[model samples]
Target: DPMVMAMLVDKMQEACQHLDRLQVRISDTRSSVLVTGDLNAGKSTFVNAILNREVVPDDQQPCTALFCEVKSVDQNDGVEEVHAIRDPEAYRRDDPTTFERLSLAHLRTVVEDNEPGYEMLKIYCRDAHGKSDSLLHNGALDISLIDSPGLNIDSMKTMALFAQQEEIDVIVFVVNAENHFTLSGREFLRTAGKEKAYLFIVVNRFDQIRRKDRCKRDVLDQIRDISPRTYAEAEHLVHFVSARKTLLNGLARSPSPMARGAMLEPASEADLADFKHLERCLRQFILEKRARSKLAPAHVYLSHLLSDLRVLLAYNAQRSARALQRLDGQRSQNEARALQLAKLRETVLDRLDDTIADTAQRVADDAERHLNRFLDHLHHIPYDVTYHGMMYLWRYADDLYRAITMRMNGLAAHIQTEAIRLSSAASSVSTVVAPPSSVSSSATTLAHRDTLGAGNVPALPELLDRAALARMARGLLPGLGALAVGLVGYARSLVAPMGAGAAASHALVTAAKRPNPLARGAFGTLAFAGTLMLFYVVADFRRPLEQQLCRAVGTHLRRTGWVRRHADATGRRAARALRQGLWRFQSDFARIQAEEAVLATQWSRERDACQQRGQRITAMTTRVAEITEQLEAINLDT
Candidate 1:
């Protein structure tokens, strides 16, 4: 983006600097006039008439092959000089000098040699009285008159040479009135007329026309038809002139007629008037054309600079829009990731909860079964008999304790496993939710339970002291009493309980008194076993032992509860971590959104500036067009 900004600034500066330089150059430029025509079109005669000297040769055959530059000299002595400039190689080969001074009378003879080295002919002439006083008489600025080769022989080459010159203020296209507009002449007009130059189409040799008025009208019509762009609606651009007549009149008025035989007939006033009108038109057009030419380059430079500015503005706007689009797309992605992380947190926590519930339930069921078996074994041991019975109960209690511990450990392991899984899930989600810099690699390490098997598991029997254990044992005494009462009622119902209570008591005593030996033995054994069971059930050893088993089972349940609690804690921690990560991501997204807002504001400002510049360019372009139109609409008026 900075690069783009730099490029935009550079382009703007470049265009502006170029326009400034062009304006400066245009301000100091000099105006020039190029005179061109077909072969034998009196172009040379026209130039000679303007200079009041035969600087350019007017012969039967084509004489001038190179461009001739006619400049006014500040020689009050009236001594005109003709200087010939030769090409370097040609001058080196034939003559050592690049410049050759020629006599004014022999200027045509030397230039007509058509030497290969001839580059240009410079004629420094002092204007004769009343001769050079017309048309090209600007006060200070010296307007050089350029005469080029005939367009018919090498029109492309000739036009190419003329096109190289700068600031062409006026173009005097001399065409023979007898031939009007030739194909080559009209083509040259089309090519040269497109330049920012005031065109004056002079029909030379007007004396050749038989019917002057009719021929003049026909010639003007022909000029309009042939070169409509040069003559269309600007009838003043077309002028009928007799350069030969004007030259003859100048010679006749000369102190010594240089060409005595050239003036066989005196020049008519009408012919003189035609020359004067042509001169006046040239003067008016040249003055205005020079003034407009000064502003032409400024107009062109503004147009070019405006065009470049518009293109640069469009490019910058497109780049800014693309950048904004990319930012918006990234913001959307961040938001989506945040939402996904949130969902993952919910899912992981729910799954951990389910795992904890299932595991806790299984461990609880196992502990309950172990406690039931221990209690049932205690019911079978006789209390009034041997010490071995007590030993057996203690041994069973120890086994139950071990079993409960193992189960609790297993439950802890399960919870740990679930915690690890939840942590892993959270870690995976973190990769997507948080940026790389914010993601913690050790986030899931809390799930590693290195202390579970190293005696850190909560022991069942150790949870309560002797007093607490004795209190819990006393708390179970009511349930034990109820069980003993129920057992006595079951024994009575099995013996006799169908009749009344007194009758059942009498029957039971009679059966005991008349017992046979085998019946006696069997009844005695049965009574002994029942009495032992009853005594054992009511012994203090059974109570204490039952309390021990209850403590072990309670301890196991507490341990499993710890596991569940750990699992819950782990789940909550992981969920909280995920939420925190998600929050960070959201925070980052918010920051990005804020940055985007700032960038958007900047983009809006740049767009406004671009729009304003575009509007200015449009206005300036319209102004340039108006100025161009005004320049084109300029004529001999203002």
Candidate 2:
């Protein structure tokens, strides 16, 4: 696309260059008349006859290889000077950078030498005609004549280039009366006709052509075929003259290709009269018909320039329009994508919140239900805890409490781990909650981030409190409450203490046969009380102790809400870890959305720029169209 744009710029530059040259040409009222013909067809002679000076040299060989422009000295501040222009487009009469100043005396040598590099030569000289005698003296317009190289097969293209210049108001196609129109002459006329269709056709050396009528007819016939429009106005546009006679009466005599003779008395006056008439007609054509002569060439060139520029501008406009369209589409798409990403991140985070809360509730409920069931099952499992007599029953109670604590702790751990996996599964639909892109493989990335690391995953909250353990251990003995009073009373009033103590008490009673009854009763009661205290210290009520310990543990766990509290803690901890990951995802997602928004802004600007470019292209195209329309109107009016 850049290459295409560059190419368009280059073409526009060329158009601008052409406009520059046109500005220079139309800047003044001076009209340029080009005298071009076949090789040595007296083109230089005709130019001299017009200026009435031989400043432009004529040679047997191709002398005027380059364009030799002749200007009156009065136009150059009344000074005679010559300039050789190397680059005509940049040529300025006073600018040293543009042209090389030459000696006026060497005008003949400069014109005849035909320098290799220079394409244009300017000659400023004093013409032979005085103020009222010449059109150059007219205040209305300034006129200059250019003598071009003789038309040849090799130089035809170059001559064509010169003749079609924007300032060339008139074309003088001088034909040698003896030879008529040569192939080169015909070809030049045919091509030049496209712009300057009406040319001043001059048949020079007419006096030497004895068969003048046939020569005139033959030239007119060639004119009709080359330019019918010019031939139709032959009386005004065509002429037959003796440039040699005019020349003999004009500049210095120099040996040339054409043979020279003494002035003959017979046709001298006729030749002079005809040459004079040609001069008069040329002046009238330049002054009276200045509009067609001056403006037509420029109009022709301007029309073509506008046509080319129109094509170029129209092409650029279409491309700009399409570019604007594409930019709009891309900008819109980026904006929509940014919006979508924003919404998706919010939705994912919301779902994660619900999942975490729901998981905590489920974990709490499962822990409460499963733990209570285990305690209930313990009521029917008496054979498992071996009752090693009522003496070691208290040891057995300690063992039972330890066993329940370990089982509950293990179950709480299992509940925590199960909560992690199920919570992860519940929120699996939200992939954005995954890790912070640190996982090496996709397989583990989701599972890894949704749950905590292995070290933290299966950890249970503290489940078994010391208070519950102490309560269960104390269950193997009687309470220090009113239950202790009832046990001692039952031992004192209802049961014998021990068989040895009873036999000892009987022997003592037999020895002191009729001692005091109060004393005897008191002794027997003290022995019984002592025995009861020792027996109660090591009671072996295994079945009742086991049930009581299990009941206390279950009661402690429920009353304190121990299992549910720990399970909820575990679930909430896992949720916080997952929520943190989701927060990271939200940050990353928002960053991406922000970047996309920036891109969309840039695209929108570019789209606006393209639209403005299309508008500019349209403006340029319109200007060109207006210029073309004006030229057409002028041509029609002319």
State residue 441's C-alpha deviation in candidate 1, in Å: 8.3
RMSD (Å) of each candidate, 1 decimal? 12.7, 13.1
Which ranges in model 1 have alpha carbons more than 4 Å from their true place? 1-32, 51-53, 73-77, 86-100, 114-118, 126-144, 152-165, 176-197, 205-235, 241-276, 283-442, 445-638
Using TM-score, give the best candidate's number.
2
TM-score of each: 0.51, 0.55
Please estimate how well model 1 matches the true structure, expressed as its whole-model Cα lDDT: 0.59
Q: For residues 1-638, what per-residue lDDT tens digits would candidate 2 score against the true structure?
A: 89987997897797687667667766767888888787778888787777676678776566777788888777778878888887888988777888888876777776666555677888888767876666555666777888887767255546555546434678888888888898767776777776665789899878877888988888888889999978987888899997867877654355533334544433467777888888877877777777667666566667776887788788888889888878877877776766666666666655657755676566556655665676678667544456577658557766776665555555655655565565565455445423342211221122321222222222111222366445545643433433455445544544333446767778666645644556445545655555565456446455556666666666655576654555555556556655654555667666766777678778878877887888889888888888878777785224
What does candidate 1's lDDT look like per residue over 1-638, in tens digits? 89987987887786667556555645654456778888878778788787666567777678777777676664213447766776523533134276777667777766677554667776767545343363334454555677878877675656665554334556778888787777777676666544333467888888878887887788777766665645563556778878887876876756544557678777799888878877776765655555544454444445455455556556655665665566567667656755665575566434644533444344344334433443345434333323235447555555554554454444444544444444344434335434532323244223323433325444544644586557645644555555555556545544533566887879877865654455444545555555665456545464555456555545554556544454445445445544555456556655655675676577566656656665665666566567656645644333
Candidate 1 residue pairs in backbone clash: none
In angstroms, give how far residue 107 of model 1 lies from its true place.
Answer: 2.5
